[model samples]
Target: MTDDTETDSDSDSNPNQNESTDKQLISGWHGRYYEDFDVGDVYKHPFGRTVTETDNVWLTNVTMNLNPMHFNEAYAAETEFGERLVDGTFVIALAVGMSVIDVSVNATANLGYDNIRHHNPVFHGDTVFAESEVVSKRELESRDHVGIVETELRAYNQHGDLVLSLERTPMVLKRSHAEPSAAEPPGWPEGIGTQPEDC
Candidate 1:
């Protein structure tokens, strides 16, 4: 006699259940593996964020970054640009953070950045966005379960102007199911770094 209600654990009868679970697992960066990236791979963050006047003002004050170029329009008017400018550090932080959902959310450690260039100044009311391109990947010599990823980070404004550029390095797990191990890679290397061969 067979019990019709007894469900087989590996049975394909409940297709929706397995499908839904798979969708949930891959929905966020948490489950992404180093295998997900390769040279020339680019991940434009899923969404763009608008920068507000409050954002600029509060960030400037809270961080104690009271430079006239960022806070005092009257003082800035006396300078070459003639208006207050958004802090460069603010632009860098916000832009990089924007890309976390697609890049570093599953990363082990932020190795470092290189060839940082402030191409243009960001101002209040200017919305910023970021796109990261994976420029290089190397398997750790000692750690079989992780890899080093180098990325070229570019930030742009709503006006389609390049505001900043840099190379970011992070250690990412080679496989989501791999066991955790003690593997630490060195920080940014010295010298004329290689540029990402844009494809």
Candidate 2:
């Protein structure tokens, strides 16, 4: 199979290469460039994360969602679910996050999300698995260096119930002159999004 990314002649493929003299090559694992995606490609993302109590409670507080069923066990046991519910927002966030490495890690910006659905409730301690399918892609006249990609994202519980779904549109960088996205999210300048120092 052909590799989609640029190959650097100076970069070493050997893990044992001299650390000081060798530069790491951009990897497909980090994310895909605009050219790498195709319509109808479905990606079952690799990472699965279990939701913790801290993840639910802290997020519920931070987002100002005071629903008792999420953080209060007493109120939850009386309900149909019979347990503290993991906030739906957290499920959605996790779904989006899971898609990032495969769908948007090299993206310039997330334009928007739509057609969201909460098909089921997620309970704390439930492991969430994510999957995404590329639905569409097109080049933008306004941004010649990038293209728009639309994907349908889904999150499922360990029992295989679909919990969340959404359609996301992102401006993905073209491989022509693109650089890897920042590994650290906080250091991006105000207008320019995070740009990794090395690609």
- The best candidate by lDDT is 2
Clashing pairs in 2: none
Top TM-score: which candidate number?
2
Q: Per-residue alpha-carbon lDDT of model 1 for 128-171, expressed as tens digits?
A: 88999989988888987778889999999888999999999988
Residue 77 error, candidate 1, Å: 2.1
- lDDT scores in order: 0.75, 0.83
Write the residue-wise lDDT of candidate 2 on 1-199 in tens digits: 1343334433445555655764443333546888999999999999799999999999999999988998789999999999998888888888899888889877878999999999998877899999999999999888889999999998899999998999999998887756543343323443463234443
RMSD of each: 12.2, 11.2
Could you give me the TM-score of model 1 versus the true structure?
0.71
Cα lDDT for residue 157, candidate 2: 90
The TM-scores of all predictions, comma-separated, are: 0.71, 0.76
